[model samples]
Structures are given as structure tokens and as C-alpha cells.
Target: MDLQLPRGMRDFPPEEKILRDEVIAILKNLFELYGFSPLETPVVERWEALSAKYSGGEEILKETFKLTDQGGRQLGLRYDLTVPLARFVGMNPTIKRPFKRYQIGTVYRDGPIKKGRTREFYQCDADIVGSSSPLADAECVQLALDVFERFKIDVVVKINNRKVLYELVRAAQIPEKFTEAAILSLDKLDKIGPDEVIREMVERGIERTSAERFLSGAQDPQAFKNSEGYRELEPVLSALRDSRVVWTPSLARGLSYYTGTIYEVYAKDSSVTGSLAAGGRYDNMIGQFLGGTEKIPAVGISFGLEPILEVLKEQRRDLPLRKTVTQVYVIPFKTLVAEGRAVCQRLRRAGIKTDIDFSAKGISDGLKYANAYAIPFVVIVGPDEVAQGKVKLRDMRSGEEQLLTVEEVARQVAQRLS
Candidate 1:
């Protein structure tokens, strides 16, 4: 039998899964606090919807895990949450306008398997649909900023409007047919440098001078003052009060759906090379799902949970080392297992994560078990202590034991853990 996981697959044991779950908890809490409602969608979609409406571009479609069901229906695992959101909105015509939702789920991509990326990973997304106002874009940026800040990861955000780049592409004499390819080539500027970007543009049939003009125009967003992209972007920049944000005219979000404001988040003073989160204004995707040119303005941010997990692991300061969620472990004298069980019930009812040893083991073995899992506290209930309605609470880390009433133990453990 094969014991090894497939390529780009991993098993997060208790120690790792605990940390990942904690991060998810914090994210879900923050998402709600920011006024976004939770949503869920199917992981598999019809190949037609997945391939057509989600046309994030050729590069993305190339990574899709396509399959055909036994019923002869073509299907594919969703590659991103945004596309699912668009499909959901388009299918439900009676849904409320300006729908705001957040979803965290697994997405599959058969692309490059790097440290921060994988074939299967979780995507945490918050999106606002049916709203075209630039404020929607700004709000998405703010959410991304707040998410990283809360995670103690310092970051800088590069904001750009696709319209801004479109005008510049036109200014460079790039024909409409070559606009998307030209933008995609320029998206590689930071990675491949100007010579390569120009080379790529030339390869895409753009004139050498026109490619150079496109690169030069990226440095100046004000050059297209009268363009609609500039007019729409001014308010987004103004509304973004965070000092971490900056307007980059050349920031093509590397996605075909982004038709307006786009942003990418990068960690500061960190070794991670990928953006922690990214999203943009995709006004035409939903309209495509609805089979029309009528734009349903949508903007969103996706927290690359795997990358965020990598960042958290790299820092190590915030990730707890505990292999178990048990905050307190209970051990009772062989004759008093019932009493110990009662105490554990009380602790759990009080909303504390508690575990008890049902084997009625010796105190030494009990304490050793707790220590192995890094359980912070141990409650020893012997006959004498049980008689007085008190127990011996031992601090595993400090090796200090205190004789206290059950109430005192509960109160102290709750306070310390809280």
C-alpha cells in the first residue's frame, strides 16, 4: 500500500491542524465583524460554467482540474471562490442587491506547486456584488489591510485601476485585439524586467516602440487625467486612508476578469514571495454568467490561506505549540474517577476546553500524559480533596501545585487561560 501523499498534498497533524484551525477561527470572526455574511457553495461546478463564465484567462483555465462524471456530465473543481460567487449571483435573480458575502473553502489548481502555492488549497474570500461604486473597491482593500494587521503581518498594498492601465495601453498604440495580451506581458514587469516585458509585448505582435511607451506610461498615472479609469480611481485612492496603500499604474492584476480597481498585498520584511491576498473589481464576469453585457459590478479580496499559513509558520511567535486544544487535564484517584468526570463536565459546561483521563492512572502517568500534549493545567482529585470539595491544581509549566476549592480552581484556570 502507498503511504506517501500525492504531489503537493500534505497531512496537517494535530499540532499543525490546530494552528490552522485557530487562524480560520480568527478570520471567520473578523469577516463577520467587518459586516460580511458567511456563504457556502459547491466545490464542483459544471464544466461549462467553470470554463466559460470564470474565464480569468488562458493561464488559469490551463490549470483547471477537468473531469467527466459517470452520468456523462462534464465537471471541474472550482479554482477560486470569486468565480463561484459570480455564478451564484447570476443564478439567483431575486437575491438582494449589493449582496455582501464571505466564504472560506478549498479550491483546486493544477498549476506550479511552490512553497506558498499548491494543487489544492483553501481560499478565504469576501466580496460585494451588484455595486459599482469605487468605495466597494476601497472597502475590499481595507478588509485585506485589516486582515494582515490582525495577523501581525506588516504589508504594503499596490492599488491600480484596470481602466487606468487600459488607457495607458491605448496611449501606447496597442490595438484593442492586443490589449489583454499586452497587459499580461506587462504584468511580468516586476519579475522579468523591462527588456523581457518589451520582448513579451513584441512577441505578442506589439511594436517595440509601443511596448516601451506602455512601460514608461506605467510610472505616471496622471498622464491619463481625462480617461474614465483615472476619474474612477481618484476617489478610491482618496478613500483609502491607510499609509500602506499606493497607486501603481502598471499593476495589472494578472487576471482577465479584473476590469477596474485591482490590488495585491505583499508582506514587508518577510521571506514570502507571493501576495498574502489579492482581489479586484471584476464588473463583467457576472454579466457573462447572465449572458449579457449588463455589468454587475463586483469587487472582492481573497486571503490565500495557505500563504497566510506559511507566514504564520514563518513568524512562529503567534503560532501556539500545543498539540491539543485541551486547556486543562483532569486525573482522579482510582476510587474517584466519577468525581473527576463530574469536574470535567463542569469545566466543559463553562465553555473551557477540558480533557479527562478515564483510565484512572497513577498521578505520575497522568501528569506525564498532560505534559506530553502541553496541557497547561492538571486537576488532581483524590479522596481527601474530594471530601473537602477542593482539588490540587498543578501548573505543568511551573511545577507549582496549589490546593484550592473546585470553584477557585475553575476561576483561576478560566482567568489564566482567558
Candidate 2:
């Protein structure tokens, strides 16, 4: 029998794995710089713990993988990081208040298979908890911008408020109960047209009159900009007056947890493809887990690593390349291998990435090996050099050779490499 990974799953080859690792490392560095610590939660949790929260009235429950453990306990792999984060905060109340954290790990969902949408994937997330202020929203936006800047990708961030969405739905005379469905339909606006949105809304049990009004009103920017959604943003807009940002009324995210300012980052040209990253303000998600006893206001964003990777791949752009920092490759005769190893160790202790050829190859072969590895400098040691307390340094790139003492060689290589 031929064994293979399940459909919608992938095994990253070395190059892809290295690229992902590099992206994760860059994210970690920037996240730490922004004062957000890290947190991790279990991949599998009780179905109740995970599902009840997303009752934001989406189809997430149907898309989750439900199963029973050996103990007959109901469990499911988490569909997203945010729900598990709320659970973590609820369980660990002793954690510092206004906790700031970032989580990067894999999440599973039994959703449909599509380009850039998989059954299992990694989400790079950072969130600020216990703060309801728009400043929290602003910082999240700024950090997201920083991520894109670090990646050297030009992007445009679209921001909207769920409250604005609710107000728009109310203005359309849609019942509050049908607001979730309306928002879900609105989320598909980019995929489907206005007519289809109206059809979906009506099919989702919204009255035809209300659905048509909602679609028609939202179609015109002036109408939307003049509605209650616009009125509610007076304070947020005033506060952001000093900070220049593009405002868009069409940024409603599809998640069930977002209670306020939701956002999505797109490539500069919409024709470029999938949303590179997205997230939103989900203030009430913790209430589902902790019963509103704890004061935990939260907002966050996640980098769609795979989608962004695909975008970069299609653009033929390289992520920031990491160079191997080895400054010296030492090759010494078999009899003097210990001396060469000692010298390599000393150079490493002096804060250089240095290695010694252990294959006991000739100096010519060792130089060739260094060139093959793209190592710039090669240190050659033989009986004469060992006796003379000196080593021959050859520049692999320039093919220049020189004789220097161990200390001089170390300093020269350090200077050149640094």
C-alpha cells in the first residue's frame, strides 16, 4: 500500500521549510519589539469550550473536526487561535492583567479545500488583552504595517467596525437576529456581486425588501458614508486624525467574534489576489468562555503565512535571505587535525562561525570544498605552518592567499566578515 499524507495536508520541503522558518523568525522579532509576549494553547480542546464561543452564528461548528478521545470525552482541533487564546486567559487568571501576547502555531479546520485555503495551516497571531481603547486597535494596525514593511511588501489595510455593520443592518430594517447572516453575506461581497449578495441574504431568511435595501444602500459609498455606521466612527476617526491611514467602509470580516473594528490587508492592486493578512477586534469572545466575570478586552491580527508566501512566490520575490555566518573553514593535515580543530574552536569562542574539514582531504580539495559551500575564507594548516605557529588563509572568492598567525588570521577574518 502506498502511504501518503491526507488530502489538504502538505509536507514542506527543505527550501519551503527554511522560507517558513525565516518568516516566523522575522515575525517573532517584530512581535517582541512591539512588547507582545508569547502564549501557546493545546491543539485539541473540549468541543464545548471551543464551539460555544463562535456562536457568532457562522458555519464554523459544521466545519470543525469533532471526535471522541479514548476517555470518551468530546474534543476537536481548534479552528483558530483566538478562541484558544480566550480559553487560556480564562484558565490562567493569575497571568498579568492587560496581557500582551503573540502565538504562532498550526490550526485545523475541516473547511472546503481551495487555493490558499487548507484543512490545516499555521496562523501567526498577536493580540492585546484587557484594553478596549482604539489605541489598542491603532497599535495592532501599526504592528501589522511593520510586518509588511519588514517583508518589503506593499499593502493597503482596510478597516471597519462591526458596530458599524450592525448599525447599517439596523438602518436597512433588518432584524437584529438576521444581522449575522447579513454580515456573512456582506463578507462575500468581494467574491459575489451585489445581486448575489441580495439573493444570499434573502435565502438566509432575510426579507426581500430588507435585503434589497441593505444591498442597494451599501453599494453607494455616499449612502454608506452618511449612515449610522459613519456616525459611530466620529470618535475613532477624530483620534486617528493625526495618524494618516486609508479608510474603507467595505472591510467587514466574516468571523463571529469580532464586535468592533475589523480589518483586512490587501495587496496594493486588488487584482493581485488573496488577502495577504487579516484580523479584527473581538471584544466579547472572552465572555463566552469566562461568562463575563473577567474583564478581558482583546484585539489582534494574524498573518496568513501561506497565502503571503504564495503571493511572494507568484511575484518572484525573495524573502530576506539569511547568509550562513561562517567566517572560516579550517583545513589541516590529518596529523594536525587536533590543532586545526583547536584553532576553529578558539575562533568560534571569539564569536565567529568557523568549521574544520574532518575528511582529512588535501589543501586543494579542502579549498574546493570551501568554495562549494560558498565559504569565503579557508584556513590551511600543514606541518610547516603548524611548526611555525602560523596558518595560510586563502580567500575563496578572490583566490588570494596569505600567511598569518592564529590571532592575526582571526582578526582579519572577523574584520572582513563583519
lDDT of each: 0.87, 0.79
Least accurate stretch of 10 residues (summed lDDT) in model 2? 316-325
lDDT of 1 at 415: 92
Please report the candidate that would top TM-score against the real structure.
1
Residue 183 of model 1, lDDT score: 88
TM-score of each: 0.95, 0.85
Off by over 4 Å in 1: 317-320
- Residue 247 lDDT in model 1? 77
Q: Please, what are the lDDT tens digits per residue for candidate 1 over residues 31-64?
A: 8988899999999998888778445687788989
Candidate 1, residue 51: lDDT: 77
Residue 16 CA error for candidate 1 (Å)?
A: 1.9
